[model samples]
Target: MTTATPHLLPGTEIAIESLPKVSLHDHLDGGLRPQTIIELADAIGLELPATDAAALGAWFAEKSDSGSLVEYLKTFDVTTAVMQTREGLERVAREFVLDLAADGVVWGEIRWAPEQHLTRGLSLDETVEAVQAGLDAGVEEARGAGHRIRVGQLVSAMRHADRGREIAELALRHRDRGVVGFDIAGAEAGFPAGRMRDAFDLLAASFFPATVHAGEADGLESIRGALLDGRALRLGHGVRLLEDITLTEEGGSTIATLGPVAEWVKDRQIALETSPSSNLQTGAIAAWGDAMVDHPLDLFYQLGFRVTVNTDNRLMSATTLSRELALVAEAFAYDLDDLLALQLNAAQAAFLPVEDREALMDTLIDGFEGAL
Candidate 1:
């Protein structure tokens, strides 16, 4: 499914890859290039299931498509294994940006847990600095290539671990650098955001923004903790929040009622970073259905919620932001206006200053207008 050149949508005769986009929930460890993974593994004397790039790429997709979160997460072990050193982190970060720029991403936020990459004797601060250096290099390279892209790091803490406070402090220490926000990621079923209340309190005290991973593997209660306890500004793949919305058939029309949790999220316009492909693979939307058309994205959009499209794990999902947009467009018959709305939603929710967000909005508008 990998291509050397851009792919075009069949009927529209438009190159979706050429449209400017924003990526909000992308993962650093989950987006490593297959070729880079092979090379890194070789350097570390690690063995992989497939030595060839194409086969290794296929392996990741197969593992992720098993429809089990446990199976899906196993692929990350391979990717993160090679990302334990400064060189590996820098290379992966730089190439990740390059790939995003090539896919017409104008702005993106790359999230990863710093604590996960410290196995090779690198300090948390060193890991962040190395990733920042790589991101800076990639931005400059993209600029030189006439592709303007800006990326910020959203430092994440593993929910199953006890380093939320340490990771929150790490993010704040690098706030003036490339770090923009904080997040808690990992299995969300058993580990509630309330367990990390101290870290969230520290972040709230420091006035740092956060976007917690909730409502994916869990239900409404996890989302509740994310909002009330974690104080998350955004909900990563908050697709399961739909459980709080009750659809009633009355008078030949289906009426949807939002529970308090869903109401708060919708009323506050907390952006839902919905990744259709990844959601399907991980069964995040299994309650709704197994197809893209069955995703609650349309319902969320129709309800006036901030529903932004995202490619959560490009490598595992074997997808790009443009491909994701195309899938949703095909499923819901979204026109150019819908695409622009999603991009605008992401721009507005970005963890950037008002001036920077406005500047990004201008660029997105100009890009869409030019595409038209």
Candidate 2:
């Protein structure tokens, strides 16, 4: 589903692909190459709906754009079906990093649930190891190819499952290896982050950071649970947080009033991992409007919220980080400086140490300056 050429800034000669970027909310299972899926499915004797790579890619994009998160998520069953083995996990992870590097991401955090891959007799720890191995190989390969990329894992627990603490421990166990943070993903409407209080409590005690999938399929209360109960450092697809913001016209100026929840998130500088195409496809921003111009990301950015652009599912959305940025730029009329600000926001919000984040910021500044 990727385009044949790099996406350039709307009225400029700059290719967005040339700027350094940081990706904080990409999904590993949601970014596999179509050809890789076909080969992996073939290895497992799994019959695919479409044998051709391009057709399979289109199929994922078609199914994912159903405007229902649940329906959109059903496409993962096919992607994950092929990701049930060690080789499958490694190859997908490696290619995921390579794709990110190709899209100009210098640092990326890939999130995936290990519990979903145990159907092939692999333990949760083994799954983490396999993915990390692939990520390392991808990083090495990218460096060899002169891309110089780095990646970490954000091991997730399925919200519908009862393995919150188990997955939390798994992430903690591999913290020094490659696991950088923790998350809980799945159906977000009924499954609040509070249900995994014990898991969040454990991570809190250990001082490990978390990014919860709230404000996407759910509303204000879910974001509340993510912060108060889950102690999330960032909100995954917090597009719906705009619900708590009230706008009114006063003397020819639009004034925005922030609710307590919105105030806290804004005051604390909690990053909103906003994915435009995926958000539109999942109806995460339906309350605002269905069009890319209607996304709250620009509003959040203008209001001084820590907003960062992302490609939540590259394969599902048939997009890359550069494409997401280019789309947002076209919709919002953002210039090179605005794009750099967004990248700096993401670099700051990344699950990395202060020195590392500073180094990444420097790299971004240098790269953007070079482009100018």
In terms of lDDT, the poorest run of 10 residues in model 2 is: 1-10
Q: Top model by TM-score, which number?
A: 2
lDDT of 1: 0.92
Each candidate: how many clashes? 0, 0
TM-score (C-alpha) between model 2 and the true structure: 0.99
lDDT of each candidate versus the true structure = 0.92, 0.94
Residue range 276-367, candidate 2, lDDT tens digits: 99999999988879999999999999999999999999999999999999999999999999999999999999999999999999999999
lDDT by residue for model 1 over 219-264, one digit each (tens)? Answer: 9999999999999889999999999999999999989999999999
Query: Best-fitting candidate, measured by lDDT?
Result: 2
lDDT agreement of model 2 with the native: 0.94
Question: In candidate 2, which residue ranges exceed 4 Å CA deviation?
Answer: none
RMSD of 1: 1.2
Candidate 1: segments with Cα more than 4 A from true spot = 5-10
